[model samples]
Each structure stands twice: as structure tokens, then as C-alpha cells.
Target: MSKNSTLILEVKNLAKKFGDYVAVDGISFDIKESEILGFLGPNGAGKSTTINCILGLIKPEVGTIRIFGKDLFKKRSEIMQEVNYCSAESNLPWSLTVNECLRAYSALYAVKNASTKIDELLERFEIAEFKNKRMRNLSFGQRARASLCKALLNDPKLLLLDEPMASMDPDVVDRGIKLLLKIQKETGMSVLYTSHNMWEIEQVASKVVFVNHGKVMAQGTALELTRQEVQLEAKEPDLREVFIQLSRKAPEMEEK
Candidate 1:
């Protein structure tokens, strides 16, 4: 999507703290319709905290979150209807079968023809064969795929994915990314994707937001961030290197 695309999510000056420890400090970013924004940062950079704030799972002590141009805290129930999130950390009931878990979510979303939607998603993820398998019986990668299926059951306008492919094999990760891009293109859905795989981000994200020490350190296309780090000598921009360089800096450097 372009800059002209309707803004799907806007976060301004968000801050949250645990006593004297700041988990997220003055973080801000926006996601436009059909845009896949790569939310990049090292561990403890508050990327997850920022996402949690947007989901309204944790209220921020400062700032506002707007989804679809409405206050997230005020219209959260309404806004959540058009939003969904997926992460490796999100767990399904272990006793339930994969299909059972998906059915539960489809019902929650009030999806019409839930059976058909579940079937399609299972097929898309190549997990139809494991539909009846208990969630606990599935491998890490299989469970991740199942979580993804549940996330899309609502055909969400805004999807938040935090390391959704962290445990998947390379082949599955590739397939998952391709399917995600295809769906986003056809549905104009916006995605806030977080992953440590810089190559994967380069492949899918239309824009990049880099956070450090709970603040936005940079925001731009991957190429732009790469260029800011090093002069390109007729070579391709390397986002991984950019990540490395920024991640290695001392916390004091972020104040500059």
C-alpha cells in the first residue's frame, strides 16, 4: 500500500511502565491499509509491549491508540472485530483438536459459514491432515500454523503477528509468507509483523519501524535504513547488517 492508503492504526506517544522500570517509552507508529509493516527490534526493545498496548491487553499510562480512526480504548470491542493477533506465545487449549480450536475462534468471530472458512484456512496452511489432532499432539511448527488459521478466521482488517514463524522450518516459513502476502494483497488487510529474520522482513514488509530502548530509533523502508548505516557501493542493501549495527550499540547511544 502507498502513503495514501487509509490509516488502519495509529499509536501516538505510548508509554507504559512497571513501577520505576519503563517497559515502553514514548513509542509511536502507524499502519496503513494493505500495508505489511515490519516491527523490528532486539529483545526487550518493547516491540511486544507496544503490540500489547495496541491490542488493549495492557493499558498504556500515557498516549492514545486509534484503530480505524476511532479511539482504541473507547471503541475497543468494536475495533477488535476488525482486528486479530497471532504469536508463537499464544496458546490454544491443548486438549482440543486443531479443528476444534479453529471452530471455537470462528464462532467467536461470528464468521458465517464457519465450516467452509475453517476448511479453506486449513487447506491454505496445509494442515488439513492434522485437523482432528489434539493441539498438544502437534509439533511446534504445526501449532504455529494452526494459530495462524485461527487469526485469519475473521478476515481481519488489521492483523498483528509476533514471531508467528519463529519455530517453522524454512520451507514452511516461505510458504507462510507467500500465503500472507497473497491474502493481504487480495483483502487490503494491514499487518504488524515482528520477526528477527531480516531476510524475511525484506521479502514481505512494505515499510519498517525499528525500535530501541523502548523508543523508535528509525522508521523507513529497509533500504533507507540500510543506506543510513552504510554507503551502498553498487551492492544490495542488507537489513540484517543494519539490525546488527543498531542492536550492538550501547543503551546510552540511543539517547543521541
Candidate 2:
């Protein structure tokens, strides 16, 4: 990250609760412009809840969310114009053809030069062959590519991706990851990335936040956390081992 990098997204003391259970508890983090930040956690952790709050899909009972140096709630319309989100569970219209889906999403964002954007996205994702294919008919890997194409329609400044490579084969996953890195580098958009693949995280993320049971347990570069407490052979440390080490320990024992 640049020394004077601007913060594109800020979550301060964010909390979300459901009934008697706390889904997310007072977590705070920031994504710098032109940075990739990974959000990781074990199953049943508060990862999803925190993401929902950040996207404004669910209201947080406490804390504030700021995007582009403005309050998310008060400036939602303005903030959303340059912000876009995507998840592997993208429930796009199954009957719609790929082109139709992209067109509709572009209209929703009111993007100009719609046809040009659609073609560029399809070619970039290597999904132009399936432009006429229906969503329900496409394979999981193909659909994943289409889903990403839709997310890029608006040329967003901030992108939130939740398991963007889910259901993709090794080759497709590699392609998708590279495309994201390229977009960020060329456009300087901030990306908040979430996935279960530790190796993928190590490959793309510049910083990481590990949360469990609605609380953040650790925050640092992958190398920092992997080597800080665990002994290694001096070669690159595995992120999965670092995750296991952090999650398996008692909260009191893990570093704050």
C-alpha cells in the first residue's frame, strides 16, 4: 500500500445481532485504494454477517460504515454509484441469456455504451462463446465467469467479492483471479475479497483480517501472521497452517 493511500472503505466498531445471538461484534477495518484485503474465518463465523453489513444489505446495530469518505447510510445513493458487489451464490435469472443478463445489470447501473461494455467484459472473462447461452444452462465454471462479468458492468471503484472463484476449475479460477488483479491495477479500485482457499488468499491479498464468533482475531500480512509465532524452515509459510494455528487456539491465547 502507498504511504499516503486513501482509505476507500471504513468500518468502525461494526456490530450485528440476531435475536439473542451476536452475529458480528464490534469489528473494524479499512481497505486502502488499490489494495486487496482478505476477510477470512471458520465456518459459522461472522464473515457473512460482516459482509452483509458492509454492503448495507443488513443494518448494523452499532458502529458506522464509511465509503469514499462519506457515511454509507446517508450517502448510500452516491456511494453505490461507484461501488459494486458480487457473490458465488449469484441468483441471476436462470432463463435469461448471458447478454440479456449483462444488459439488464448495466441498465440498473445506468451504464452508457452498454453494448461496448458488455462485449469488453465477455471477451475479458473469456465467456464470449457463451454470450447467447442461458444462465441455467451454463456449467458452474461458466456461470461463475458470467457472474463476474455482471459485477464489472458499472466499472465500479470499490468491488466486494464473496468467494468469486467458487465452483470454478483450476484454470478458470486462475483466469478469474488474474482478471481481478488486472482490474485493480489498471483502475486503482479497492477490492474486499473473501474465500476459503488459503493458497488463493496468499496469492492475491495484500492484507488480511481473521474473524471468528463475531470478533476479529488477527489482522496482518500473510507473512507476518504465518511467521510471527509459529516456527518455520525459513521458506514461505503456508497460510492454511497459520489459519489452523490461529483458529484452533483459545481466543484468550491468540494474539489480538
Candidate 3:
């Protein structure tokens, strides 16, 4: 792909299955460089399964995942060197100090000038004071910051974030969002982020993919999706409204 093409991550007909259950039913999408793509869906709507397929963490029953025009599974090492992920449930070693964990991740990613990068991230996230604190001693917000720092340790070209703002205070979430925007601007990294918070997604995502029943029900800019709903004469058309219209099991009664 040419630099001007902008496509950074591409998924074509991706599907995943566990015995008789299909988690992702041949979903496809692409994320472009310097773009923050939001993956939105209800619980068990295959968001996580799709992410796992993109990361090559689980083998999909069908379809292809390409990073920078290279097959993700065939070129795992090359793909991984330029990609990273952060998720809410991912844990740090409880016995390791914050600094140590960062260093360990830096080593794993073979980041040059690892110590300098770790120090810079520590200061950037305002966690320098807790650098020597054990992982078990850090609050949930602090751990989230640390996870983000680790994900960016190698300065990846593609960053996958699953609820990056979870467990963060309002102040911390503000800081984190700013830091994420700054990083994307500086490094030109493409981000594929999943979130349940419609407000947060509206704030950060340039485009969105809405999934339901293991398939993409809608894909467009957030504003486009909202407007589409309004054109359909749906009551109080908004992202949440569209989400409910598409995925809600029962018709939601509009409050008087």
C-alpha cells in the first residue's frame, strides 16, 4: 500500500467460532493511519472476538487480517513489532515495581533507549511518584496508565485499546485522552478502540463500526450514524438511540 492510501489495518470476512457458536460472523473493516476507529457494540456482540482475531491471538475460522499489507498471521513478528494492545482486564505482575514492569515490557518489545522512554512516560502520565511502588499497591487508574505506557513502549504504528478509559477518574481520563491524541499526532499511529461509553466515543472516534449479532449493522462517522437515525424518523435520534434501535430486544418507550 502506498503511504497516501492511509489504510493501516484491514480485516476481510473475518469469522471466529467455538464449536457450534459463532462469535464473529465474517465481519470486515479497515482502519487508516492517524485515524481513531471506534468499535461499538452491546455485550457479547463480538467486539472482543473481532479484536482478538485482528491481533492473531485466536485463530479465526475464516478471513484475513492484514497490517500494512502483510498477512498478520504469516508475518506475526513483523506485524507485532509495529502493533500493541491495551485492555482493561490485562494485568501486570503483582510483585514487580511499576518501573520494573515497564522495563520488562520495553525489553520484550526491544525498545531502544528503554529507560528514557519509561521515564518520559512516567512523567507524562503523572505516575513518576509511583514508579517504585509495587503493582499490587497501585490503584486501578494507575494500573490503567501503566498498561497504556507499556503498550506505547515501542512506539507502535497501530494501537488497539479496549476501554482505555475504564477505571480512570475524570481528571485522569481527561489527561489520558489528551495524551492519546498527542501520541497519535506525533507518531501517526492508527488506533482501533472499543468502548461502551457513547459520550467518550463521540469525543474521540473519527469513524465507527456498529456490530450486532456478529455482523456489522452500520458503519460510518459518528455524526453520519446519528443523522441516519434521524432521517429514519426514529425518536430522539442519537448514537445511543441508534444503538438501541438496532440492538435493543424490545421497543424503548420514549419518556414524555
Candidate 4:
């Protein structure tokens, strides 16, 4: 999509706290239509906290969130219909089969032709063989793929994914990335993808946002961020090197 594409999501100066500790501090970012914005941060940099605020699952103490140009707080119910989230930490019913879990979500999302959609997602994730397998019986990678299928059941206009490929084998991860790219191209869907896999982000994201200590430390295309000598000290200017440098260097600022 063009840089002029409509903004699918906008978060401005978001902040959140847990009593004595700050979880999110003055974070801001936006996602444009059909764009994949990769959110990069260290373990405690509040990436997940920011995502929760965007999903309306957690209220921020300060700041505004808008999705599709509408106030997320005021139009949460309506806005959520067009948004979906998937994460490695999320879980489906342990006793239910993959097919059963997906069928239930399709109904919840009020998806039409649910059967066909479910089958297609299963095939896309290469998990059709495990459709009838119970969630507890599947491996971590398999379960993660199943959760991803659930996220797409509604064909959400905005998708939030956190470490969705964390445990997948390289081959499956590649296929999953390709499938997401294909879907995004065909549907103009926007994705807020958070992952530690710098290589994966470099492959799929057009823009990357780096956050440390709940603040946006930097953002740009992968090449731009890597090329910035002050922002990254990588000899080769690679994304993985950039991540390591930022994590080490940015954390010191968190305490100041």
C-alpha cells in the first residue's frame, strides 16, 4: 500500500502503570492499511502492554487509541468486529479439537461459510491433519498455528500478532509468513506484528517500530534503521545486530 493509505490504527502518547511501576510510558505509533508494522522491543519494553491497550483488553492510564478513524474507547464493540489478535501466550480450550475450537470461533465471529474458511485456514497452516486432534495433544508449534487460524477466521481488517511464529520450524515459519503476505495483499489487511525474530520481521514488515522502556526509541524501514549509525552499531547493519545493539544500549536509558 502507498504511504498515503488510510491509517488503520493510531495510538498516541499511551501510558500505563501498575502501582509503583510503569509498564507503558508515552508510547506512540500507527499502522496504515495493508501495512505490516513490526513492533520490536526487549522482554520488558512493554510491547505486549501496548498491544493490550490497542485491543481494548487493558485500559491505558493516559492517551488515545483510534482504529479505522474511530475512537477505540467509545466504539470498542463495533471496532472489535474488525480487529483480531493472536499470540503465543494465548490458549484455546485444552480439551477441544482444533476443528471444534475453530468452529466455535467462527460462530462467535459470525463468519459465513465457516466450514470452508476453517478448512482453508487449516490447509494454509498445514495443520489439517491435526484438526481433529485435541489442543492438549498438539505440539506447541501446531497449537500456535491453530491459534493463528482462529485469528483469521473473521478476516479482521486489523490483526495483532505477538510472537506467532515463536516455536515453529523454519519451513513452517516461512510458509506462514508467505501466507500472511498473500492474505494481506489480497485483502488490504493491516497487521501489528511483534516478534523477536528480526529476520522474520525483515522479511514481512515494511516498517519497524523499536520500543524500549515503554517509549518509542526509533522507527523506520529495516534498511533505514540499520543504516542509521547512531541508532545501530552493527558492522554489517543487519536487523539481528540492530536488535542486539538496541536491547543492550536502550535499557540503560530506561533507568534514567
For each candidate, the alpha-carbon lDDT, in order, equals 0.90, 0.86, 0.84, 0.89
> Which residue pairs collide, candidate 1?
none
Who is ahead in lDDT, 2 or 3?
Answer: 2
For 136-175, candidate 2 gives per-residue lDDT tens digits of 9999888988988888899888888888887899887887
lDDT of 3 by residue, 6-83 (tens): 789999998888888878887899988788998998989899889888888899989999999899989988889899
Among these predictions, the greatest TM-score belongs to: 1
Better of 1 and 2 by TM-score: 1
Measured on C-alpha atoms, candidate 3 has an lDDT of: 0.84
Ranking by lDDT: 1, 4, 2, 3
Q: For every candidate structure, what is the RMSD over all alpha carbons to the true structure, in angstroms? A: 1.8, 2.4, 5.1, 2.2
The window of 10 residues in a row where model 3 has the poorest summed lDDT is: 247-256
**What is the TM-score of candidate 3?**
0.91
Q: Which stretches of model 3 miss by more than 4 angstroms?
A: 1-3, 231-237, 249-256
Check candidate 3 and list the clashing pairs. none
Q: By descending TM-score, how would the candidates be arranged?
A: 1, 2, 4, 3
- Writing each residue's lDDT as its tens digit, candidate 1 over 32-96 gives 88889999999999998999999999999999999999999999999998899999875889999
lDDT of 4 by residue, 10-121 (tens): 9999999988688899888899988999999999899999999998989999999999999999999999988999998757999999999999999888999999999999
